[model samples]
Target: MNANVSIQSYGLVAEFDTPGDAMRAASSIRDAGFRKWDVHTPFPVHGLDAAMGIKNSPVGWFTFFGGCTGYTTGMLMIWFMNGFDYKIVVGGKPLFSPFYAFPVCYELTILFAAFATLIGMCFLNRLPRLYHPLLKNRRFAAVTHDKFFVVIETADPKYSPVETRKLLETAGSRHIELIEE
Candidate 1:
């Protein structure tokens, strides 16, 4: 069957009328073992993550480590600059004062964590998508309005347009489209 697939197409998109249906479809897809499927909705849907079998995002770990590194760097910089580099013993105060360096270390920790979080989010989500084949589907526009959708990528090992379409339909999807890459 010449499905007329495209290189840009992530996969097939199936539109459901309601969040309930979409959630059900997502759960079904998850259970069916499609690893690269995603559900799109106008707003975040409760329990959708569980339905998708997604675990807690790893961004938190990135932030935590980034913060730690930042804190260490900040502390080290303060210590080295004041104690060793310049050796400015001002007002008879010790050069490596932990109390004086606390704020900078705290700020640097937050700053690095923030940057890492942004970078991690971008990397994890594959941001700057620029364009998606689903955008070509006029019906997909409703996804941002009141519609919900589930997209199963063709790159999935189990992807079969015919079978996937049937699965979506069975899961209560109404408008199923073969999105090109």
Candidate 2:
């Protein structure tokens, strides 16, 4: 296996011709007690997540954290810069008035959350990764078209190329191939 192309170190990939077959294969793979696998499709397929046993993404938590940071920073900035440091006496209002700072705080909260969501998603997913070992397998191009693919990472304790391929075949995958990472 070439180091540049193999991202997972070892894995078995099974390709399906139709989304229905792919979904069925996913369910079968889950029922077979295998974990550490992923499914790729050309487009969104209903019930695919449930079949793969994937839970909701954790990106929301990251966005929340970003919002919190933004809100706090915005409030502090207004308070120190306008209220305390400059001591603006507009309309005879008291310093550190929450009413005047509400808009800035609200805007900052939204800005930070959006920024965090984008950056967090990229970081968590290891984005900017231009090279993937899976590319070495020319057959994987079908994933962008009408094909569906399921890859079981070799890192899983239960994974073996031969056994995995056989399982995929039994599960009705049309084609099975070894993907080196």
Best by TM-score: 1
TM-scores vs. true structure, each candidate = 0.91, 0.90
Residue lDDT tens for model 2, 1-181: 7778734456888888888888998998888878888889999999998998888989999899999999999889999998778886778878887888889989999999999999999998999899877778889987897788898888887877677778899879877777766
List ranges where model 1 is wrong by over 4 Å. 1-9
Task: Residues 1-181, candidate 1: write the lDDT tens digits.
Answer: 6678535657888888889999889889999999988899999999999999999999998899999999999999999899888888788888898889999999999999999999989988899689778888899999899999899998999998789889999998778888776
- Measured over all alpha carbons after superposition, the RMSD of each candidate to the real structure, in angstroms, is 3.0, 3.0
**Could you tell me the lDDT of residue 131 within candidate 2?**
83
Worst 10 residues of 1 by lDDT: 1-10
Worst 10 residues of 2 by lDDT: 1-10
Misplaced by over 4 Å in model 2 are 1-9
- Give the per-residue Cα lDDT of candidate 2 at 53: 85
